[model samples]
Target: MSADQSVAIVDDDDFFRKALERVFHSAGFRTESFAAAEAFLASYIPKDEACIILDLRMPRLGGLELLDRLKERGIDVPVIIYTGNADVPVTVQAMQAGAYAVVEKPLSSELLITRVRAAITDARARRTRRNQSASARAKLKLLTEREIEVARHLTEGLSSPEMADLLGISPRTVDAHRANLLRKLEIRSIAALARLFVLTELGDS
Candidate 1:
């Protein structure tokens, strides 16, 4: 995760919120607390890079409702539910609703920190994968039919001379196509391009 990653905590209890905020701050996370789920939802953007620490029960727009809204919107921020309510059905529901973890309250500082870090890490990984997919799609959009063919060959470790021979073009033309490929793909080197190609292939699959 980047230094700017945020963790939003939504708990109605004032003292607990402050304590958790302090703990998260001490653990080197940029933390924000909201007394209500509605306040947090209204104030915060649904950024995939951020993680949410939500109280399972709240006044209006409870954590479960908030999670439902997030899912409906296709927002994939990781959620860690923390609540004193340890009912089996509630825990099972939270997990089924796609919460990263459901933590029981009277929260252990060490355990909370560890879970938050892991959730943030998971969120960051998901965000990175989504961004890569978007980038690959953008690059694919920029490609002409010929360029797509060239890119496929490039991923196969074909040299410009070899590509030129295969495509019945001059080596200079192949070099030009390769340069265009790099710019269109927004990648610097063959390795990066190859990685993009792999991602594209995986996305297709």
Candidate 2:
């Protein structure tokens, strides 16, 4: 996690919320507490290196509802749902809705801190990957029409001569385009260029 990474604790229970805050603070981690999910949403603070410890049974905006809203808003912040009662269906739904983990109430302070640190670390990695994909997409936009055409063919495992034949261009011209593509994309191999396409496409999540 980065130096400024934090943990957000959203729960209606004053006792539990303060306990978590103390545990995190004692561990030298930054934290922000919210009385309810709605308050957290209303604040609308986005953190690249933070995760949420969300209570599952809050009134009005419950954990599941908040999870769905986060999904709708394209928020991929890792969430660990905390619930006092262990409901099988709700736990399954939370996981399916993309919760990082679910912990039943009466959680051990040590275990909770462990999970929070792991979630924050995972969130940081995801943010880094997203930034890299965005950078790759921006760089890809610099390519000319012909260069993009060459890039697609390169990803399809086409040799210079094969691509030239398909486009009705000379093999030497295709090779020149390939060279330009490698330099423009700052990639060394055909495989690496193809990998970028895969990474950037999945970044929509």
Best by TM-score: 2
**lDDT of candidate 1 over 157-176, digit per residue (tens):** 99889999999999898888
Instruction: Give candidate 1's whole-model lDDT.
Output: 0.82
Clashes of each: 0, 0
Superposed model 2: Cα runs more than 4 Å off: 1-3, 72-75, 155-157, 186-192
Candidate 2: Cα lDDT at 101: 93
- The whole-model C-alpha lDDT of candidate 2 against the native structure comes to 0.86
What pairs collide in candidate 2?
Answer: none
In lDDT terms, which candidate is top? 2
Cα lDDT tens digits, model 2, 1-205, are 3347678999999998999888887877788999999899888576777879899989889998999999888887899999987588888999998899999988888998888879878777777778878877887887888988999999998988999999999999998988988898899998888877777775555
TM-score of 1: 0.68
